[model samples]
Target chain A: MLRREMNAPRDNIVEIRDLHFSRGARKIFDGLNVDIKRGQVTAIMGPSGTGKTTLLRLITRQLRPDHGTIVVDGVDIANLNKAELYKLRKRFGMLFQNGALLTDLSVFENVAFPLREHTNLSNRLIRHVVLTKLHAVGLRGAADMMPGELSGGMARRVALARAMATDPDILIYDEPFVGLDPISMGVIVRLVRRMNDALGISSILVSHDVDEISTVSDCSYLLSDGKVAASGSPDELNRASSELVRQFMHGMADGPVAFHFAAPDYAEQLLGRDSE
Target chain B: MPRELWITFVEFVRTFGALTLFLVELLIQVPRVFVRRFRLIVAQVYNAGSLSLVIIMVCGAFVGGVLALQGYANLTRFNAEDAVGIFAGFALIKELGPVITALLFAGRAGTALASEIGLMKATDQLSAMEMMAVDPIRRVVLPRFLGGVIAMPLLTAVFSMIGLLGAHMVGVMLLSIDVGAFWQQMQSTLDLRDVSEGILKSVVFGVIASLLAVWEGYNAIPTAEGVSRATTRTVVLTAIAVLITDFMITAWFLR
Candidate 1:
C-alpha cells in the first residue's frame, strides 16, 4: 500500500444525513445520521441485525438508500451514475465478514488482483507490490498457496492485504473479527490502527466486538433504533447514560434489544390456554 | 386474486426483466472479454471445454455405436444395409450433436459456472471486487460466459466427429458393413445444409447455456441454499431452453 498525506484533522471524510432504508416492509435505517472523520478509525457498533453491515453497503453504494443522501469526500453519492460511482469507489477498500478471498487464486494473486486490474504495472513490479502487501500482513511466505489451503486467520490477513493492495483513501471492514481466534482478533485490531496511521487513510470498522473496537478505534458510535445511541471514546461510552449503550458495551443479553422474538405468551401458547 | 399468486406473478416478471437486461449486458461484455481478458477466457475454456472432453467423448461414442447397431438391423430388413451409415450421419449431424452436447454442457460446464459464481457472490468476493473498483461482470462473469460460449460449439464439433468415427468402427467391424459404402455414402448424403444446421443449433445453445449459467449465478441469493437452488435452476432452465430452441430451429430450417 502506498503512503499518502494525512487528512486534515477534524475534517469529515464521510457524512450521512436523514438516511432511510427498508427491506420489504421492515425499516432498517430511519432518519439515521453519522459522520466518519478523516484519517481516523471509526467503529460503528450495534446489536445483531441492527444493519451495521447494511450501513457499510449504503456508504459503498452497494445498496442504495430508499431516501436521503450519503456524501463521501463532499460528493453526494446518491447522485453519481454507475461510472461516477465506480470512480468514487476507487477510494474505498472493503474487507467482508468472511474474508472473501478468491477461492481459485493463490494468496499472491488475490493480493495482486486489484493492482493488476487497475494498474499496468509490469510483472516484476507487480510481484514486488504483491510481496510488499503480503509482507505487510505477515503472509508473504504463504503467497503461492491457494486460499483454501490457508487457515481462517491467514485468509483474513490475506484479504487485508488484498484490501490494501491499491492504497485506497478509505478502508471499510465489515465484521473483520467475526470468526477469528483471540490472537487473530488482536492482530486485526492492531492492523486496523496501524494501517490507518501509517497510510494516513480513514477506516470505517463495522463491528460489535466491544473490546476490539475499544482497542482499535479513535472514535466509536453505538447504534440503537436506527440512530446513534452513544458516540464517544470507549471510556465515555462505558460511562454513558443510555440503557442500550450500557447493555451493548457490557454485553448484557436483555435490554433495549429484546431477548425474545415478540411471540405470544410462552406458557399460554404451550398449554393452549389463551383464546385467539 | 390470492396474495401468494400475485407475489409469484410479480416475482416472475421481475426475474424476466432482470434476465433480459443481463442478456443484453452479457452480449456487450462478451466481445470485450475477448479483447482484453484473453488469458481469463482461455483458462475458463480449459475448464469448460478440456475438462468436459472425456464425458462428452464417451457418451458420444456410445450413442454412435447404438445408432449403428439399430440402423444396420433396420436397413438389413429392407435390403438397404448401405443406408445405415447415411442414417447415422444424418441423425448425428442434424440433431444428436447439438442437443446432446448442450445437455452434457449443462451438466458439466453449466453447473460448474453457476455454482462457482454463486459461491463467489455468497462469499462476498464479488462485492469485494466492486469495492476495489473492479466490475465483477467484466472481470468474472464475462470471461466464464465467453468461455462457455466458445466451448459449446467446439464440444459439439468434437462430439459429432467422435460419434461418426464410432459409428464407422461399429458399422465396418461388428455389422460386416462394406467400408467404402459406410463412409462414402454418408459423405455424399450429408451436404452443407446439414452441417450448418448443427453448427447453428450449437451456437444458439451456446449463447443460451452460457448466458443462463452466469445469469442464475450473478443474481443468486448469497447463501448456501440459494447457490444450490441457482445451480439447479441453471441445469433445468438450460435443458428446457435447449429443447425448445432446438425444435424451433429444426422447424425453421426444414421449412
Candidate 2:
C-alpha cells in the first residue's frame, strides 16, 4: 500500500554529501554531491565510466562509499543495518542495463515474483496484478513468453514491468534506452513519462543518449570528473557554455575526453631524438 | 619471509571468518525457509534427489557386481566361496554405498546447483530478490541445502538396496551359490550400527557437498567463465571433502 506524495514539495528523495569512492589507485568520486528530486525524472548524463551506474548502486546501498553519507528517504543508508537496508531498498526498483530478467522464468512469472515474495495475494490475484503490470508497458500479449524468446526491446519492457511490479516509489533506470531501435526508443520514452506521472513515482535515468534524455527528462545532471559538471533543464543544458558539457551533449569526438590515449610525441618518438 | 607468513595467516583467518558467517546465516534462515517456502524445498528434493536416482542405481548395481566377482574369485581360492555375500554386503553397506553415492551426487547434483545459482547471480536474479526484500539465502540456498541433506540418505539407501540385490543376483544365480545361504548370511552379518553409520556418513557428506556448492555459487564472480569455474570447483572440492569426511567418520566409528 505504498502511495506517492505527489503534492508534497519536490524535495530530494535521495541526497549525497561529500561522497568519496575509489577503486584501487583510481579515484572515481571525490567529495561528490547530488540530489534526486521527488516525483520527477532526473537524468544523469556522463561519459562512459564516469560512475553513473556506480551512483545508482550507491543510492541502492549495493555498494558502500569510502566516505560521506547517502541519505535515501531521509535515512542515512550508510548507518542502516542489514534489515533496515533491505527495508529501504523495497521502496526503490531498478531496471538494469541488460534488462536482467530472471531467465528461468517466463515473462508473466518474472513480473509476478516480487508480488509473490512480498505480498499475501492469492494465485488468482497475483495473475491479475501481473497482467495489469504487463499491460502498463504494452506487453500483456507477451506475458507467456520466455526472456530469451523476446527481442531486446521486448525484454526491456518486460523488465520494466517487473521493476514496477511492486509499485515502488522510486524507479532507477540504468541505460534503459540503450540498444533499442528508434520505435522501441520512442515507446520507452513515452512509457517512462507515462508511468512516472501515472504512478506518481520519482525516477532516475542514467543514459548517454542525449536526444532521448532531453525529450524525456524533466531535469538533467551532467557528471564529469566525479562531480556535477552541469545541472539544468534539457534546454538549459543544450544552451550551456561549459565546453565539457557541450562536447558531451553534442557527442563530439575531440574535446575534454581525448580521442587517443596519451603517448610520447609522434615526431620525437619516430626520430628517436634522445634515445632515452 | 615474515611478511609472507603474516599475509598467509591473515588470509586464512579472513577466509575462515567469512565461511563461519556464511554458515551462521544459512542456519538462521533454515527454519524460515521450511516455514514459508516448503514447496521450494520439495521442488529441490525432486531436482537433487529424484533426478539422481537412475545414476545412483546404475552405479550401485555395477559396483556390487564387481565386488561380488572379485570377492568370489579371491575367496574361492581359499575354499571360502560361501563368504562372498558377507564380503559384498559389508563393503556395500559399510563403505561403498555412502562414499560412491556422495561422489556421484557431487558430480551430478552438486555441480548443477552451483551452476544454477551461479547463473542466477550472474544474471542479477539474486540481487533482484534482495531488492524485493527477500533473502536469497532463505529463498535459494536453504531449500537446496535441506534438499541435499534429505536426498543423501534416501539415495544412499537406494544404492545399498540395489547393490544387495546385484550381489544376490551374481552370487546366487550366476555363480550357482545357494540363495538361502546368501540371503541368510547377509541378513545376519549386517548390523544396525553398520546401516546407521552409512546413513550418518551420507548425511554429513550431503551437508558438506551442498554447502560448498551453494557457497561457491553465491560467491562466484558473476560471469560466464566464473560460473563454469564454480561448477568445476563444486565437483572437485565436494569429492575431496566427501573422502576426507568419510575417513574421519570411519575412524571415529572404529575407535
The parts of candidate 1 lying over 4 Å away from their true place are A1-10, A272-276, B1-17
* TM-score, candidate number 1: 0.94
lDDT of 1 by residue, A46-119 (tens): 98888999999999999999999998997889889988988988889888888889898899899999888889
Query: After superposing candidate 2, which stretches have Cα over 4 Å from the reference?
Result: A1-10, A261-276, B1-13
lDDT of each: 0.90, 0.89
Residue B229 CA displacement from its true place in model 2, Å: 1.3
DockQ, 0 to 1 scale, candidate 1:
0.80
**For candidate 2, lDDT tens digit of each residue in B36-90?**
9999899999999977899999999989888888888899999988888888999
Residues B198-245 of candidate 1 have per-residue lDDT tens digits of: 999999999999999999898889999999999999999999999999
Docking class of 1: high
At residue A215, candidate 2 shows an lDDT of 91
